[model samples]
Target: INIIMDTLAGLAFAGEAALSRYMLEKPIPKDEQLISEDMWASILINGSVAALASLFFLNYAPIRELFSRGMPIESEKAEAIFLTAFFGFFVFMHAFNTFNARTQGLNLFEHILENKLFLGIIFLIFTVQTTFIYIGGDVLRTVPLEPMEWLYMVMFALVLIPVDLVRKWVRNVWFGNPVQTRVNQ
Candidate 1:
């Protein structure tokens, strides 16, 4: 998780342009924590969503059949293919969550392309992950997935986009900007 999610995601986040509004806010006091309550809220909620999805996918039944295409699930090759899909799903899920993790704002794509390095890294992450699914073969215990299967996993993982967006909108409307509050701890 750390290597796959953090390296590229962190780079993308680190590339975000600092808002000029940051200059207007009062300087954080020494004793106060940098992360605010709003951040904690988004973090906990989105993180929980990802964790739950992971727990949900760690199974072997109907889902495996969907990926099995035709091979008997009991066969070693079918098991490898199942494992491959499972791993691929896990990677793509985190990749989708990366967009959510980068912001507390309502617009997940706001100014995303403005950061060229960030965009490049995101594209790179996707490309490399896809390549891994194909070339990874025996060593990585992966098999190339069909296009529709790839789409299925991505579409399912993308559930986080709306979920996080709603969470952000609700927080923005009912709660307010996270940066306005302070965490003394």
Candidate 2:
């Protein structure tokens, strides 16, 4: 699961980096260069997806049954721990990646409204992931999750946003407009 999460992060990072490069190369007025709204939208969309996916793992009975083939567990507590760790780690990692890709050497809060295509791609990827996990059934090896579980997942995944926002705020205060400096040069 960690490997899968890491691979997804790497792909997301590479894609975002390419998009950022393209955006930087485009000739736009300095005052109009920020992509703040689009960045926020991307972060929210990707974070929500991770949170929703994690919810599916909350109802572990079905998952354990599916994996164990109905065999009794040696220890239910151990199983729960393993399941939580596996799912939680993936959720947080992906959520972190969402912000990581968007905030690379850029002031997230200062970007006005650029990068709509990047945001759209993130949403598209999330929609596909959700569809496969929920509707793909046996083909995807996923169990249908309850609404409450989804709520939990969404709440958990959103935790990264505020944390990253704070980090970006600190960077802005300390570093003093690195993005604008690059743009000016």
Candidate 3:
């Protein structure tokens, strides 16, 4: 089941890559000139390289142990499946996110800075909360693992998956209409 899911995720990533390429090759209006072949190529190459480096780094004992977190033995097959799905989703997410920002008329630098700040704050909050919970008391004993975490994660991902739809909606309602907002200089 996990392998099948992982394969599906990989296929999805491949589809996203193809879609990005297609978007790059198409003509973009002056107001929506964000998707470019150079940008897509850079993203694709860098993402693939990062994934490869992560896979190689995971072989190191320290890195492996860090991820293991003193947990008991799990199936190696499951680990591979998890890793595959992780990378696949990561690639697709990055592609979709950049595509969304481009289609939104957001400058790359500003968009990245904003997103990094948001992610950093979320990471800090989660880290501090988890640390305090562990230090202050054994909350893990009282709170059993719930499927809600998985559900929330899935929902979070699904929200991003509609980037193209949102772009189309925005264009149709806001920009794609006959009304031009520019002033003649």
Candidate 4:
């Protein structure tokens, strides 16, 4: 399952890379070039989606039950920890990926809007997953999760975005030519 999922994610990333290249081929006006605001917007949008998914679905009983169903593990705490770690890592990974993909090595913001279709697909996938885990509890052999668990998941998942943003800022200050060039004039 991990292999399959990783393959699918790799494919999705390849698609995003193709889209980014295609978009970059277009001629963009100087005034419409990437700005700091656009970078912030991209970070906020992607980060918020990841945080929400972690908060709402990570420790949800249904998802936990789904994992616990085949295992001989009897402790709910163990299940919760496993699921939290698994989903939390996923949420952070995707959020970081979003930041990397949006920047696309140029540290530009235009790529973010250029790949709206990809972002929408991500949103759709999350929605479908949430629905499946929530509504298919009986068939999936999962249980609903408590609100507190959701909170914990969210808090853990929320750290990645700010860290990435700071990294971007540092890059901008030391290695970024775009922002500095614009400011020098």
Candidate 5:
């Protein structure tokens, strides 16, 4: 199930990336744009809220079991919190990616690849840590993380805005590139 979902998610991500490229390249009239600031803002706000809610619910085992049992919350009150959390995180991440790609469709592909590099580093570190823990025969339970971890996440989020700004600036100033458009003469 995980493999299937992972494959499907990749396909969907690729299609979305392609669509973003098309949207970026397709010329807009004086009015039309692929993504408006309002739209992106709303998506970001709502997605953040939903992701938080998912995390909260997932932390409660009763909620998780309820959904897994396929019982009504009102009557049986069973919830699959993990499933809900997974879907929530999955959807929000994709929405964020789509919004992020709106202004940089051509470079969106490049950014995706760059992000993969970062993700790979993160995963490698995590795997090494997990391996060391397992070798020591330590139980794999959630550890209490430092406040710095949260601070780091916040910093990362803040970094994205400036990263985009820098990319746009470099593209336009140093590279003399305009917004991506199809049929560049």
Candidate 6:
């Protein structure tokens, strides 16, 4: 599963087109660090936010009951709703990382729609992952989740975007703005 996810990620990241911001930024020197401090800020902050949110969904009661399907909750059932939510978001957070990884800076949505391949790959990831929850049954250890469960999960994972935006804003506040040479200005 991890391999599959990484492959999808590679495809999504590679397909992103050059954005206008690319024109404004100065080129990196040959000896510069591969990952900048800003990138690390985003990596730590957004990744922590997503992981914490997934753990929250795992413990949230309403979600547990919603996915439980009348199975006795305290009985340590294998297909419990809370567990289901965890698995869904496990796949979802990885699926959604495409958005977080899309940008060198914070404006992830800039020129977003211009890349049809990225959009399609994301669609494939989400659609297939959800479908697996329904059809995977014993192999996937998933109980069928209602559509509302899915909506809640997707919206829940969507919080990564706002969390990242705030992370970027805070980065600018403490570390100063990104050094973009305003070339062709």
Among all candidates shown, the one with the greatest TM-score: 1
Q: Could you give me the TM-score of model 5 versus the true structure? A: 0.29
- lDDT: which is higher, 1 or 6? 1
Candidate 6, lDDT over the whole model: 0.72
TM-score of 2: 0.47
Which window of 10 residues has the lowest lDDT sum in candidate 5?
Answer: 136-145
lDDT of 1 by residue, 1-185 (tens): 46667787788777788765566667778999888776687788878987787677656477777778788978887787777777777777778777777666767786787788778887877887888889998788788888877877677678678888898888868976564442221
Question: TM-scores of all models?
Answer: 0.87, 0.47, 0.28, 0.46, 0.29, 0.82
Instruction: Using TM-score, rank the candidates from best to worst.
Output: 1, 6, 2, 4, 5, 3
Clash pairs (backbone) in predicted model 6: none
Weakest lDDT window of 10 consecutive positions for candidate 2: 104-113
Please give the CA lDDT of all the candidate structures.
0.76, 0.51, 0.39, 0.52, 0.42, 0.72
- Residue 21, model 3: lDDT of 32
Best by lDDT: 1
Candidate 4 residue-wise lDDT, 56-92, digit = tens:
5554666454445355435865564445445434644
Worst 10 residues of 6 by lDDT: 176-185
Candidate 5 local lDDT, residue 108? 42
lDDT of 5 at 80: 26
**Candidate 2 lDDT over residue span 1-185, tens digit each:** 44344555455545443445446754768788476653664467655755665565555566444333244644554454334333444545464456555664444522413545445545555565556446755564454444554444456555556555555556567765446555555
What is candidate 3's lDDT per residue for 1-185, written digit by digit as tens?
23323443334334222223344454547897585443464456545654554455445444333333255325453343334333333333443344343322333233344344344433443344334323423332212112443332234333343544444455557654211212111
- What lDDT score goes with residue 170 in model 2? 65
**Stretches of candidate 1 above 4 Å error?**
179-185
For model 4 the local lDDT of residue 18 reads 45
Sort order, lDDT high to low: 1, 6, 4, 2, 5, 3
